[model samples]
Target: MKKNKKNFETKFWAGFEAGNPFEASDALFDFAHLDYYKRNLTQAVIYSFKEEICSNNTPSEIFIFYKAIGSFLKIYYSLHKKSSKWKVKEPVRTEDVFHLTSLTKEEYDNPFTVFQKAFAETAFKDFEFFLAEIINLSLSPCKEDWNIDLMSPYIHLIKMLDAGELMRERGLEKIKK
Candidate 1:
């Protein structure tokens, strides 16, 4: 059982690295179904996001990664609220994983800055919706209702926007050449 669980987790990370959202999402759904202590689940989410941001990926890939993170968070938060058995006194904050410093005007024009802006604008909205849905779904009698897929039309919109941003960046580079 343990070996199978490890293999399942390996599939998730492998899919994540390859930017395959469907594979990662399916693996994550299976992994989340396994019995987990609250601390371990929270740690999984924190570490997953930390690793994602640290790695170099395209903007659309990052969007997909964020969706996966948001999906995981939905499960984590639902479990946390629905159970009174465990309490996390000091939950891992996002700032702890994502180190953000002030940037100059010149720095603001960079690709990273564009990603930061998109994250603030789009990803944050997705997280907010997921959180709201989680809260609403918690009252349901069915556990299956707790599983919320983050992939939607909104995600496609963000992907299209990211692609447009990438094209604009490439155009700027070509002009500079």
Candidate 2:
């Protein structure tokens, strides 16, 4: 089992290096096969890799994140379904974290549906602001240790845009320097 897991990782990473997005599915499968108890902080690492390092497209990544997080959230969601070992500690539901499921099979049935409901259930203000900041503006408010800091430039860029002081008109290269 251990050798199989290692080989799975190797093949997945090799496919990643080869720029084949389809391998991401096999990697996702290998990822899902892990014992939940052993996942620990590695869950975030896997999630962030799927969100950032593995992808070069920002909106595409966000689409994947949004489209997949319901499945992810449901891992914590089933805990509160009245048949689990865990309990919901917070009455207020937030997207980033919650106490519910734990990556069970039920959560994997249809991830996109979960995300659609999640997006619909979320307050528009929260959804829109996050979309503007993270999507339109390209920020990483959803920080996980494996990813880079995207807030500083996002902040500076939004400020400039809001104030109508952007330098893109001056030149695209000017934003970095």
Candidate 3:
């Protein structure tokens, strides 16, 4: 309801014009609302999730992730109320955020739900930003946007599931030589 602490909308647009939307510190995590992102990133994110879970998780593991995903969506949706001061490129409705992955904000995911398992065991913050970036790609207003595919965010994300794993993989690699 109140103005965002920072004028992130202006900053995001400015950053986009300057190149590197994700590189900016001021962009809000406002991707779910973009129509372009919904069409494009949805499948990419789905693929990335499947790739991540294959090694260590049962097909059934995603069932547990749904609960967490639903909770975060509710928080995301509420932040963009009609009265909010943030600028909007495209107006969003409650239905705009819908997906097979999202049955309801308060509803629980079925055990076998694809998204539930991937999301359940995953870190919420990365997933949130990851989704936001996906949305940004989908909603890019013009040409010359970042080459990020909806699926690519998950590649990094899968690796991000565990801090120790990331630290060891990159941290050790960087330190190795």
Candidate 4:
């Protein structure tokens, strides 16, 4: 059983590296298979956000953070708009997710301050629940049986988010020199 599991994982990674979504999806029909993908992908995105975006003190740091997170929310909500349990009346826009425009100049300047304000708001709470639902759905043991396709969008979004983070890192380096 362990050897078979390893074989599946090996195939999954090969499919992933080869950019063959169908192959990858095929290899992820089991709970352990899907969980492995979910854990690694989620960690990568969260780790990158915490280390790269959260730690940055640049003037546009807050904007970058919002853009990344808001992109996730926008994509998640858009994909699940009709069927999502967390029914958002309006579309999730990156700019509107944090209500950053309403912030005072002082709050705008400090990314931490902006985060504090946003974190305390209802929007953030909704976002938290929405995120939790995504995580839970992704890890569902019977996810492969579900008619609704969820993983593909998440996989695409993860790649896009990673690319955006790489670009942001390059831009930040340029700003420093």
The residue pairs in collision within model 4 are none
Best by TM-score: 4
lDDT of 1 by residue, 29-140 (tens): 4444322212232332333333232232343433444444454443333322322332222223323322112233333233333333435555555755743443333323
Estimate the Cα RMSD of every predicted model relative to the unseen true structure: 19.2, 20.8, 18.9, 20.1
> Would you give me the overall lDDT of model 4?
0.34
Which candidate tops lDDT? 1
- The true-versus-predicted C-alpha distance at residue 39 of model 1, in Å, is 22
Each prediction's Cα lDDT score? 0.35, 0.29, 0.32, 0.34
TM-score per candidate: 0.22, 0.22, 0.24, 0.25
Which residue pairs in candidate 1 collide? Answer: none
Q: Candidate 3 — number of clashing residue pairs?
A: 8
Residue by residue across 3-66, what tens digits does model 3's lDDT show? 5442223222223321221222112223222233233334434444342322213433232233
lDDT (Cα, tens digit) per residue for candidate 2, span 1-177: 333211212232223321222233333334343223123223333444343432334445444433232222222122112122222122132342222232223323222233334434443334334333344223343544424344433232222121111111111111121
- What's model 3's TM-score? 0.24
How well does model 1 score by local distance difference test?
0.35
Residue 134 CA displacement from its true place in model 4, Å: 3.5
Per-residue lDDT of model 4, residues 46-89, tens digit only:
43323232232453433333333443344323322222222112
